[model samples]
Target: MIELKHVNKYYRNDEEELHVLKDINMSVEAGEMIAVMGPSGSGKSTLINTLGFIDTKFDGEYLFEGENLVTSSDDRLSKVRNQIVGFVFQNFSLIENNTVYENVELPLLYNGYGFHETKERVMDALVKVGIADKADKHPKQLSGGQQQRVAIARALINQPSFIIADEPTGALDTHTSTEIMELFRELNRKESATIFLVTHDPEVVPYCDRLISIRDGAIIEDRAVIHE
Candidate 1:
């Protein structure tokens, strides 16, 4: 569903330019769950941002479902991001004052869905993430796992074709992280949603179908995970 060809990214200051991603080339297929693993400063997150169209200041080609994002206009990129990509951040990125229901409903509202349809979609997403009952609760009232579930629900409400999860389970306990990863596995299996997970945890890597390891802005390893 997505491909990056010889992609490069850099950050520039008045003094010098630092290359953060060097000749990164990768492909992710539909219904595939892949992990991009690397330590801090390794450009894994930059790679994710590039794939999600969250970072557009890069060189080379990024093709999403056949369209070259590098050549696409800002308006087109924005539309694609809203309609095709869903993002989950390590921080949960929830609105503290909004209830879970409202939080999940924001995307639909932004996408111009009617009230009834928005309500239905939000509820369905919450149910899918196993958090339907907590719709009325605020983010602070929920546990870390529950809050992350809310974030996932928000990401899924749009039924996006691609889900970009950056350190999704970074703050959760081990058991909770396993639960979340299992949930992602189910989503990949049953819903056919392509997932690109950016994480540093080796335990989380086992849940993915493929592992792409990066170091110092370069991919050092890319391999499929074998299951017995």
Candidate 2:
């Protein structure tokens, strides 16, 4: 569902240019759960940002479900992100003042959904994430795992075809992380959402259907695991 051809990303320092991604050619198919593993400064986040259409300043072509995302306009890109992409960050980017319900409903508000539709979508998302009962609680009132679930609920409220998660289990404990990973696996298998996950933990690799390892801005290993 996603393709990147000869993608190159560069940044400028005071006197030197930083090459973040070098000729990165990759493709992700629909209904596939892929884990992206890399060490620090290995361009994992850059790839994620490029795929999410958040960072548009780069070289090469990005195709999303057959559309050339590289040449797409900002308005078009925003629409693609809103309708086709869902993002989950490590820190669980939940609003401090808003309750879980409001946080999940914020995207619907921006998408111009009416009150009734927004309420339905939000409630459905909360239930899907198993956090419907915690809808009225603030972020601080819940545990880290619960907050992450709420964030995932917010992301899923749009019913996007693909999810991009960066360090999804970074802040939670091992047990909580396992729980979150199980939730993600369920979403991938049951909901048929293609997942592009970036994580530094090797322990999370077994949870994914496929694993792609990157080093020095290049993909070194790509394999699909077959479990017994």
Task: Looking at model 2, report the run of 10 residues with the lowest lDDT sum.
Answer: 219-228
Pairs with steric clashes in candidate 2: none
Model 1 weakest lDDT span, ten residues long: 63-72
RMSD of 2: 1.2
lDDT of candidates 1 onward, in order: 0.90, 0.90
Runs in model 1 with CA error above 4 Å?
none
lDDT of 1 by residue, 58-100 (tens): 9889888888865679988887788889999888999999999
**Model 1 lDDT vs. the true structure?**
0.90
- Which digits, one per residue and each the tens of the lDDT, describe model 2 over residues 113-187? 887778877988999899899989999999999999999998898899899999999999999999999999999
What's every prediction's RMSD, in angstroms? 1.1, 1.2
